[model samples]
Target: MKNYDKYTREYFTPPVSSLKWTQKEYITAPPTWCSVDLRDGNQALVVPMNLQEKLEYFQLLLQIGFKEIEVGFPAASETEFAFLRTLIEQDLIPEDVTIQVLTQSREHIIRKTFEALQGVNKAIVHLYNSTSVAQREQVFRKSKAEIIDIAISGAELVKTCAAQTDGNFQFQYSPESFTGTEVEFALEICNRVLDVWQPTAQNKVIINLPATVSLSMPHIYASQIEYMSEHLNYRDHVILSLHPHNDRGTGVADAELGMLAGGQRVEGTLFGNGERTGNVDVITLALNLFSHGVNPHLHLENIPEIMSEYERLTRMKVSKRHPYAGELVFTAFSGSHQDAIAKGMKWREEGNGPHWSVPYLLIDPKDIGREYEGDIIRINSQSGKGGIGYVLEQNFGIDLPGEMREAVGYRVKGVSDRLHKELIPDEIYEIFIEEYVNITAPLELINYCFTHRDDYEATVSVRMGEELKEFTGVGNGRLDAISNALRTNLGMDYTNLVYKEHALEIGSESQAVTYIGITASEGTVYWGCGIDNDVMTSSVKALFSVVNKLHHSTSTQRLVNNR
Candidate 1:
């Protein structure tokens, strides 16, 4: 007979081995990608999206193959209700998709929620309220009896309101902050809700006992969930779900432990974009299962499209450090990682990589729309011969001698350190030629001019190698003009060069540096750097610099005598 408080206290603090795992499951594999991005995500935002943006974002979520999406709290705002109504009126929802709205215990709000769902064919009214001691003490400041009363009233209202809808309607209730809630009390209240709704096995009600927050170690959460899993008498009549917040950066771990404890449902947003530290990064979590050979049923190949849509709708930037979908996640900057990935490539060519050289990769980058060739990043201080060699092999299918690779890699690193970024294949070739080929003359750009003004007309001309190369073009910027200059006079084709600039120094007076990553003929990537006080000039120069380097390197190489 464990005291409820004592049992919970113990559950919140447990041993590691009890939660450490070797296997994982992603329900999305069987196609159960639940999107809480708009709901949980909206609440987390300090400046929530406008109603139009919210509607657009909701539609975008469905486009990513999420059959069920948590839209927003209908009971909370008029704007939210309007967003829900917009979805209903437009009939924009897919037949297979279900829209979900959230609410609390107040009878008035629940009735309003019912009004909002009047014409919906399929929907979920997620009823939630805090149930744990932490909520009582810290948030609600209620006694146990008072909290239980709140729970019962809330559950009753949700049932009454949901009955108004004829189509597939679901009632999901969460013992909010359930991670720190006592089992008996939590169970008592949840069981009462079940008794009132009496949801059958086939039409089972969801009892979402979220970790709400990571209260302690993974094992403790596991134990608490396990205890609840074993204690439930009408298990077949309920869907036990878990929603874990990564407050301590272990939301993924806590959720995994809950699944280990028999939880069958998960709730999260893409890229873990939510309040505070965000929810468990669903991409990382799902792919984690994929790495271990569990089919999480999710089409991971759709990640880039999802990322692009998310970035557009949310107007939020995804950090490069973000896992899976981030620009840098699959890239390896360390020499050792590059060496291993390169060897893996060779073994792949030999048709034996799955067993041979696979240390750096847990999953193939190509499976997620990432180029395996880009894995060996030539960043400063950590790059080596392996990175340079791999880049040349990938871009040109030509191998450099090991000794030249070392020398070339060194020169590239020196420039990369000065430039502070990953050098591309053409940049590597330029640096290689500059170091190996004898260049008695350095062609300095004495003067350059590029102007983009008066409704997007642009032009550029530069004095280079004692000759004037002038080119005019119509584009959105001066960089485009300079690229035109290179294409017209330098015998360099105008490859699509992406100019992404960043300020290297702090404050308003800081100089902006432009890093141009160019994709040229034969799919080769070239990098160039430029610095200036003005953004457009820096970007233009960076674009031209790479072309200049490429032309000079090739010409200089041809002039050398092999004999």
Candidate 2:
């Protein structure tokens, strides 16, 4: 903390004041997305991908709907050169997709880059040279004039190669490390390149402003983009692009605000895989629009398959907390969060609205190859009764009473806490059954005969410990009649019987589930559940369960007091 004085704001602000981009709420449309996973992302890996691996990743980018993908720097290595040749010779390049390759200002590398482009249908020859202040004095050891000459020479060479080459080609130039360059100087170099390419409506140029090393907050980057958007030559014929890296962990924010400042395209890798912190994540950017009710023009519905192929090909593990594509992004482990999510999902289900407005979730998990049963409301020591009850109703179709859910939640949480692990759906169901369903110990239901003469008279035979006892009572309903019979004949001091029933709607079994709650003499409530094919039988079993639960609680209290 004492070294704080060493860090200063090295970023330059745009010349224009009161930027208009700050007034925008959100991006109304998605930008043209270009994936550099095969180039920028591959080079950063501990081990570069092989030929077959590169091919597999290329196909994945195509499947993900990338119209422009930077395949690799063909002239940098033999494998990269060979990968381009394979794509061209094998006719693997789709007609609609245009592959881009990176190169520098040197002549031999430019020539060899064009050689790899032979027989290709369409491609972008991307030429770049660092123009930052540090690069000029330290890395490149060149003056401002020399840097401009490097970019202009590369621009002219790219034009000459496009004319001689056998394939269709376009031009793109990036002032690499543009964020570290003065705004006016960055514009000057880019305008000189535009002069050589002479981009038209049909043949547009892409001037990518890469945050090669992010140095400041996103607002500063947004201001830089706005300055470029306003002052750049051939503005109508140029597709302003942004390639933001996450050095400061604000790449996504930078891209969003940059787009609002008039950027028309994005260049990033999936899951933000690249140099340093990584490239801005295209998946996160695209789905952010999807969550805002705008189509991102990318097929991200099957995210699991995309993630699987990405990890397999790149050998880079996607973080479990990665936005939109992580394993646990939609999962809620906090009790309050789970409860709100549960209620929100139920509201959506009952209304069946067109828009997604779930409380904790920005978008529906089901829309992206995720499920609510296990993925959304996960049970743990921190889980609450609402979530536990939602799991039962949503997965197994057993809706527990409100008070009963509290009791069952505590029991489930106790088990999870002691074991120090999360409980799965089947395990939670098993716990529910073991703790509260059809529990008969001190009092067991033998049989019941109900005669509806005046109201409803019921004669029930029950086993109390080792004795078989018969009880008779009258009430309006069969459940009430059984409760009356138990209290009157067995001297059980309980009242205010409450119950609810519903038909099981999930899975293969056809049965009815009933919940019963009763208040004992000490004003303590006991709850139980019964599942059976017949509703009447399930109700009787439910009442018996509550009686046994009440007796067990009293006995436990008595033992504790004696101790």
Candidate 3:
């Protein structure tokens, strides 16, 4: 907070007001995306990618549907020039895609840049010079007229070099550090360059407005773009492009608003990898359009694969919290969020709507090669009954009853809390099995038979703490008869027996699962589950499980009270 007065606003507002971009609600279409990963991104790396790595990365960009990619500054180094030659010599460049190379306004760099494209089918000769006031006063130490001469001479040389070269060429010019340059001077310099090129519809030239150093809010950049778009000499024949840096962490915003203000193309790197804070993240920009129902015109169906390849080739780790592609972006750990997501998934499963409207999710994970099980309802100390129950049902096909899920939730959360870790689906399933399913302590069924008289009659042989016995009782139903037999024979007291059964569709089609709930005298409900080939056997086992749970819980409570 100290010495804050040293910092001052460096960006310039246009001489005239241009507020027409404010009326647009959203970007209706995706911009012309040109990836600079091999150029700008590689230059920022600690160890630049080798020829092989660049080749693989170029193929990846092609797969991601980039029609234009800036390969590198050919005159920068031998490696840069060789990489371009490799792509052209090996015929690695696709016919529909164009490779671009950056060069300074100097004649030799322009000649070598064109030399790298000797046999290329199609290419863009990108020319740029620093035009910001800081570069003029401190770096170049030249007047505005001298800077304009540099751009014009470079444009003339590039046009001359392309004519003598053996490839179809397009021209793109950028006033580097355009953000810190005076808007009027920026306009004048761009118009002067256009006068020489005289671009037409069939041969449109790109006039790139770069926020080489982002210094203001996004609206200011948008208004600047609007001024350029409206006042450019060859407005219809020029492709207005934006290349925003993320020094202020708003490169994506600048690009979006600039597009809304009549910019037609974007030049950025994937994952925002470039100098300083990095270029605008083309992935974020494209996916933002996608979330708004516009096709980003890129194949992003498998973000995980793209991230893996990007990391492997570039040696850069995509953060786990990165938007849309991050590992934890779709994971919900909060109890309330988990509950809503679980319910939303169920709602979606029931054919509620044709569109994806799930709670706590901006887009469906499955649409981006992510699964719902581990990626969605991850269980920790903060998990809720709905999320835990949803995990059980989705992973193991064990749907807990509505009344029973809260009880199971507490038990699971207690284990996770004590262990200080998240429980995987298998671990959660094991906990369910050990704590509630077919428990056979204090009361166990050895054998049983049922008969239907006017009332159903049942007889059972059971074990209780190393003792075996037999009992008989008659009730309105078979399960009720078994309950009556146990209560009478064991002198146990309970009421309000609840039972439900369903076929076990996951592990075995022939097996059936049954759930039972019984209210103790102290007004606490104990729950249990059983699985067997026969529905009747499962139901009887479920009843016994509930009785065992009740006995153990009471025993533990009494021990605690006595202590």
Top lDDT prediction, candidate number: 3
Cα deviation of 91, candidate 1, in Å: 1.4
TM-score of each: 0.64, 0.68, 0.68
User: How well is each residue in 174-213 modelled by candidate 3, as lDDT tens digits?
Assistant: 9999999999999999999999899999999999999999
Candidate 2 TM-score, true structure as reference: 0.68
Q: Which stretches of candidate 2 lie over 4 Å from their true place?
A: 375-563
TM-score of 3: 0.68
| 231 Cα displacement, candidate 3 (Å) | 0.5
State the RMSD for candidate 1.
15.8
lDDT of 1 by residue, 1-563 (tens): 55655644323432223333325443333224578988888777767888888888877766556787888888788888888888888897889888888888888888888888888888877887888776798888999889878878888877766666655688888888887777677777888777777888667788887767777877677777766666665788777777878887888877777777777778888788888888867778788777766777666785666676676566565776677766666778899998988877877888873543366777777777777556534434345466676776565443444444555566777898788676777777666545433222333344455454663444554566576655566555556655665566556654766656666443334666666666656565555556678776666656656676566666665689543
Structure candidate 2, residue pairs in collision: none
Worst 10 residues of 2 by lDDT: 371-380
Better of 1 and 3 by lDDT: 3
Q: Model 1, poorest ten-residue lDDT window?
A: 13-22
Better of 1 and 3 by TM-score: 3
Q: Show the lowest summed lDDT stretch of 10 residues, model 3.
A: 372-381
Candidate lDDT values, in order: 0.70, 0.89, 0.91
